[model samples]
Target: MLAAMPPSPSKPRNGGESHIRDRVRDRADACPGALRLHRADDGGLARLRLPTGVLTAHQVAVLAGAAERLGDGRLGVTSRGNLDLRGLPDDCGLALAELLGEAGLLPSAAHERVRNMVVSPLCGLDGRSHGDAQAWARELDALLCARTWTTALSGRFLFAVDDGRGDVAGLGGDVTLLAEPGGCALVRIGGLSWRVAAGDAPSAALAAAEAFLAVAREAGTGAWRVAELPDDRPLEAAVTECLAGAGVATSAASPGAVPVAAPPEPGVVGDRAVSVVAPLGRITAEQFRALAPGPGGEVRVTPWRGFVVAGLPGRAAAKERLAALDRAGFLTRPGSPWLTVSACTGRPGCGKALADVRADARPLDDAAVRGLPVHWSGCDRRCGHPQGDWVDVLATGDGTYGITVRTARRDNDDAQAQR
Candidate 1:
């Protein structure tokens, strides 16, 4: 749904614009969606944004089939609880879109890419939840897809509906609704939260999106994301004003506890579900197809770059699959080496990369990385760092790397240690 704005001539030649232009020029580095495919160095990359991380079994199978037939057969579960199919052939964009649309995966062609929504993976399954956020997520998604103006929103505009545990809200969403008791919810936009009646969640969220777009347009900043907007256009105040205009009551609530639970470290959550981690968020085509559960069973892809097969037949079978995955070098055990480290594709896939950061980083055992979560990058664009806090290892064009640890260190320690 996201459209690229023409570059502004009056804008200064900042490095940010240059980088974006370079990406756009090379392979049309647009964010991949079901309809608009991104041509990576490897091939075409298609990202299927799964709003609410909920998919029917049939939909999943269709995705698997598309990946096998049109793509390279490997599927990537992204940190946004979305799926990516790489190595796609040319001219497959329309066909793939049609296939996904037939499966109800592409509800709206214009809104397909902008429908970035995430909810608690355990919203309904977890007993401690305030209430099911799934319904609200669906309602909001429907509203988003139906809006023609929403096509102007950037592909990165995120909406998260958390079921009161503060899970999805912690990831810093453009618009977030945290479920509360007494049939009410807390709505937040750009770090500010407001309590609203539960019945107003969807409308309030839509209002927030509209307010954001208004601010972006007024700012004339050519900013595509909420975070990039100038300081004068405070998103919170705009959202509040928009909601009031819609006759929705609101009250401020400070951002609450967002748990730092790492992806379920390769264990049994309960008698029914088994968690599996795809190392570096990559899974082969055969692995994806083989992992699809039977009828009445489902897979829940977590925002932490992992997935769970819920309602398994037995613990033994699940354990066997987990062990097999582990043997294939996937992380399925608590404290596994792959759990602590994450890296973006470097030399081969990205032209901006200075080195093969992923390959160079593969040898560093996670057990040796102490203190904080560590993310390796090929360039300054640290695509995905731990949402809360983490150590950053940035690569220089000269093949050296700089490390920035978020934790306090001893007197002799250096924050920007070079390696």
Candidate 2:
């Protein structure tokens, strides 16, 4: 799939109805994909998109070997449930691509980057969901790759298939499908939503995206996300027409708040699923080896910094497996310090960074941060910050740091403190 992308110009974009600083991206994003590596200060950076975040033990081994042989022997996890391999030698891109293709990780060259989908990772196994979101996710991924128009979607465009769980729906997907009771789903585009048959969720989601493209084209802006549309654009009307053109029926969603579920803690769920938290959202080859199940077992990585291994023999067995993972340095219990802290690739990895934030960051005890995340950044870009509430620890010149605490505050206020 990586090899399929033609060497296109990193073209700059122009013309738009209106633009906001955040939504106004004047250039196409050069976000690295598994095949499209980015030249970072830490050498080549390759991001592998894992739809549904499912990977087998064999795949894990392949990645581990690649990390050891090509990268810096560490696997970084993205908030979107994707995997990243950094510090790769420039000449090893072809080798990495070959390995990924052979492992079936690169299914469609054209659709690899657009496969930015996050679903309810613990769905089917937990029995806490209204429907099987994992099934929907797979079906949706297949549907996405089958259509050629989906290739036009920006790499940042994301899809969320939530099993009536609010956890991932709030993760900011351009097109979101929240499963509802009675075999129905709420398809949301921007703020507008429509209720449709669960079976048609994939088509509805695509239709909504098609509508976004139409509105964006009319706006004449190189807008990448639905939230970037001009103020004059009517999302609801456009989406409705697009769905109608697709021969899909829809009904206005009921007026209410979307339900949400907090992330699952590292433990056994019911009698089948077991979760192990990856400390600092980073894991090593040996750590991954310790977490892999025997042949035929499955692992589903979650949006949060860990993955859930379902298909356990029983609840008792899951406890044992989770305990083993804990021993291997995974955060297996709640209230662990690793749960409330994260940092970006500091100093040696990012050329723009002034400090090695990862090295300087420490796990924050719960009471210290009071359950709010504390992200350490090497510079003001504050890359890889968490989606929700958090404290920003940004490095300023001359060994000083700037701190900004943001949480539901659209307008931010900043404070400065010295190291």
Candidate 3:
């Protein structure tokens, strides 16, 4: 099963007592970007946002080379379709930026961090999707880069473009565009949704984000996302007004109209692509090279911390590529324990971590870790833990870890808590 990203809405902790904190923000988000590197225990960390997670083989080779020369040789796959380069020297920001710019990965430095978008990896490759969500994401990315005001959006803010297949619609995007069967798309923000023409979907999403900025300014709450807005300040009406003013006709969509589907499993997707994941979302330099496609081959990064290599010649060719990746230490097929296991950078990399969670988790391949998802975290933040019911293995300062089961549904808490 594909591990879920942390849910957008907070789940109650310590027996459903409501662990929700103040939604108002007090400071600017220090989220790292290609231009601004985050200082980590290891070194400076740079994140390159791949809008729609589309990367060329040449781009992949460039990133791998940069990781080897400037940072750690391993590339980190984040929950969003972004890449993280850790263990970099303090002065390598300029060098790294230069390399990414040469590779065409840095399109606009001003909007580098705000281009946080996730698109269904198998959108057009497989005939399952109703429309090409990746195309829409490209249009939206251009729009975001052109608008200076979008720079104010928090790096944590996300946008998802899902083909009618529903793979990415449930990814907890601040703004989501779900393609429908009738040449229209469902634009959603928080709990509200509106239907718009497929051709106008990208603009509608941009308009929705613009409306949120205005509402957030009016509330004076320093809210970074729609979910963080105060109860009294809803974004529904403002988004509606923005859509109407932009000349985009929208009709109210039923909650049932929302598409719900699981993420693409690791294997041959349809007949033209293959999906795979590295154990614990860590891709070594050699493995990264193995994932590089030919001149114009597309590699899509999935939100589940996986890679979807699409546009293969055929299923046999896809399987051959999968075999090559499997030989390079990637989990090319499902059923491996690593498929359901994930851990954060602990000990040496994260100053707050109590232990080396990745080291602790790497040995579990031989262990019978089955059933629900398992996430090993270094601290309470549970940084990249999966959503819904999960086995929480938290480091406890000592060599041991505190184990617990977290369930999203209140009614299933007792029944689902295995440990």
Give model 1's TM-score versus the native structure: 0.82
The lowest-lDDT stretch of 10 consecutive residues in candidate 1 is: 1-10
Model 2 clash pairs are 1-109, 166-260
Candidate 2: lDDT of 286?
81
Give per-model TM-scores.
Answer: 0.82, 0.89, 0.89
Q: What are the root-mean-square deviations of the candidates from the true structure over C-alphas?
A: 7.8, 7.5, 6.4
lDDT of each: 0.71, 0.78, 0.81
Name the top lDDT candidate.
Answer: 3
Clashes of each: 1, 2, 0
lDDT of 1 by residue, 191-266 (tens): 4567778888888888988988897766565556655554422565577677878777776465554443334557
Model 1 error, position 184 (Å): 2.7
Clashing pairs in 3: none
Tens digits of per-residue lDDT, candidate 3, 1-419, equal: 11212112323332452232333678988899999999999999999999989888888899999999999898999878789999999999889989999999988999999999989888887688887798999999999999899999999898989998887786768899999897999888766677888999999999999989987787686877766665322466677677877788876566464566876788998887899987888888888888877655788888888898877888899999999988988887777667778898887899999999998984343244455678899998788876666788899987898777686554234422421
Model 3 ranges with Cα > 4 A deviation: 1-23, 362-369, 409-419
- Model 2 local distance difference test score: 0.78
**Cα RMSD for predicted model 1:** 7.8
